[model samples]
Target: MAARTVKRRHVSSRLSCKLFIVFTVSIFCVVVLVTAVRRNVPLDFLWGAFFQNGDVSNFSIYVHSTPGFVLDESTTRSHFFYGRQLTNSIQVLWGESSMIQAERLLLSAALEDPANQRFVLLSDSCVPLYNFSYVYNYIMVSPRSFVDSFLDAKEGRYNPRMSPKIPREKWRKGSQWVTLVRNHAEVIVDDEVIFSVFKRYCKRRPPIDIRKGKLNLKLQKQHNCIPDEHYVQTLLALHGLEGELERRTVTYTLWNQSATKTDNKGWHPITFSYANAGPRKIKEIKDISHVYYETEYRTEWCHSNSTSVPCFLFARKFSRGAAMRLLSDGVIDHFELSALLGNE
Candidate 1:
């Protein structure tokens, strides 16, 4: 009887192990390319490197371009993006509700693939901090999605007019670039109530000069609200999915502190030039282990599967010249090689 029991236990363990492997292999990540133009030059090679040693089936790509633009070989260098543009894409404007519309469209398209267990939103300028395997393992092992959500106290960007449909208490702010799980992505796609309120009330306040000629005095007083910045964060909060998010963005961005809202220059994230896209700058971003949100007084320590990990998986706002430098420097390729050796 004891011998029979031992044999049965061993058989069950082997079966469980095989099932786990199958589950892991079946799961894949969807990279949502949310950009107006074709994919950046370096990203083509960098992403190619990602799948060089792995199965292409383990991941998928979807691009959300403007209405007329297509992501074929004429516009992009890689064959991966050929014919990836969404047929239903609309014209996208900065700081407008249209930006969020593009995101929703991309999510809706990616969700069609049931095998996509994770969804990561990336821009044309965004670059991977680690190799594909590291990023895959980091995102796949986590139980929750990565979203940079925090209280909107400062800036007073939250419009009071949106209250009732979107209460001030539930109004949150964060980076538009986020990595969501399948459930959260579905929530974003299915949402109609909060998104309608945002389109109606939440809009970017026109610049002082532009408002003088194009707007009435009433439009001048409207609160400045960047829809993409607040839409995902607020929508998730409204759904009471706060516990299911990491509350921090994996795509790091450096804002130009000198450019204030009052200045005609306007506020924008700093774009990396070829001079600043060297090894040291990349290392600095990689070294970030925690992020402190001043408004909420919360510090988010990065982790994957309970083990401490770097805060950012990707960094954005790189110019085409800077991106080319990254490829020429072998910076990304080195990481891919190191990641492969580490696994062995």
Candidate 2:
């Protein structure tokens, strides 16, 4: 009689516990849905792009678009759209500390689910060169991070004003579009000491010249301290996380100067236009065997202080039309998107 009663009680307790979990998850889902409809950009096309060669469940797509829009009407039709958009979305300004803040926001949101192992940050302008499985396996198998971190002391990249707080040896710069591991992501959010200086002192402002009769706007140069580029890279290097640095971006950005108009010059990569797509230009870009670099700029290895890594995986600054052209012109097709998925 005692054994039977005990068994019965255990069964009842297990059932009740499962019921409690299910009820809690149900409420959490409701909250996430309400949050999705509130703020954030509609990543409809970006979502579709990721799943072009594989299922949506394979990856989690998040967009930090400006001019936040209502996602309620859009999410109504689609089940997958539920709880994917992020709340606490930030307004991103070019070459400002806000850029770094927005990145932290994405990291914080994605870090909520421990299932997300590798987090790839991309802009709406960015596109995938390889299909799903290739990207997934490639990033997952790598032991090091794919961030472009290098020291550029001479190019006005390091700020002397930030001296004792941020020492000369610690200043670093690199591409903001990067893939970070969970540990690195946590470091970014939990960081307060280094990030505070950027929020207050180091600012990149617009240039102006208003003479007696002429009103002229000299173009905005690079930020006094590009926090997004500097902060993450410097933190990793300063903390002796140097071995884990891949120092090469998967995204390819053209560094050549444009032939058209020369005004408001900055460190802007050439935006390959869809209009520029031709047999000649297409041939030039297809020769990806050689990596492109600005004639005047170089990022030498700080470890050995000698080597430079090649670009791999994807390219950036390509116009939407240019991306489509790569698809239509058979660059992406030439890579054989289907091989990513084996016969399994």
Instruction: Give the best candidate by lDDT.
Output: 1
- After TM-score superposition, the amount by which residue 66's alpha carbon in candidate 1 deviates from its true location, in angstroms, is 1.4
Q: Candidate 2: worst 10 consecutive residues by lDDT? A: 1-10
Candidate 2 regions with alpha-carbon error over 4 angstroms: 1-49, 71-83, 211-223, 256-264, 277-310, 330-344
Candidate 2 lDDT (Cα, whole model)? 0.51
Q: Which stretches of candidate 1 lie over 4 Å from their true place?
A: 1-28, 33-43, 210-218, 334-344
Q: How many backbone clashes does every candidate have?
A: 0, 1
Tell me each candidate's TM-score.
0.84, 0.69
lDDT of 1 by residue, 1-344 (tens): 00000000001121111100000000124444444543333355555554454446556677676566666665655565566667887777888888888888888877876666778887766776676667777887787889988888766678788888888888888888788888998999999988899899888887666536756566667787889889999999999999988988888887766755467555578999989989888888888888877777677888766778888877878876676667666755643433432232
> Roughly what TM-score does model 1 have, to 2 decimal places?
0.84
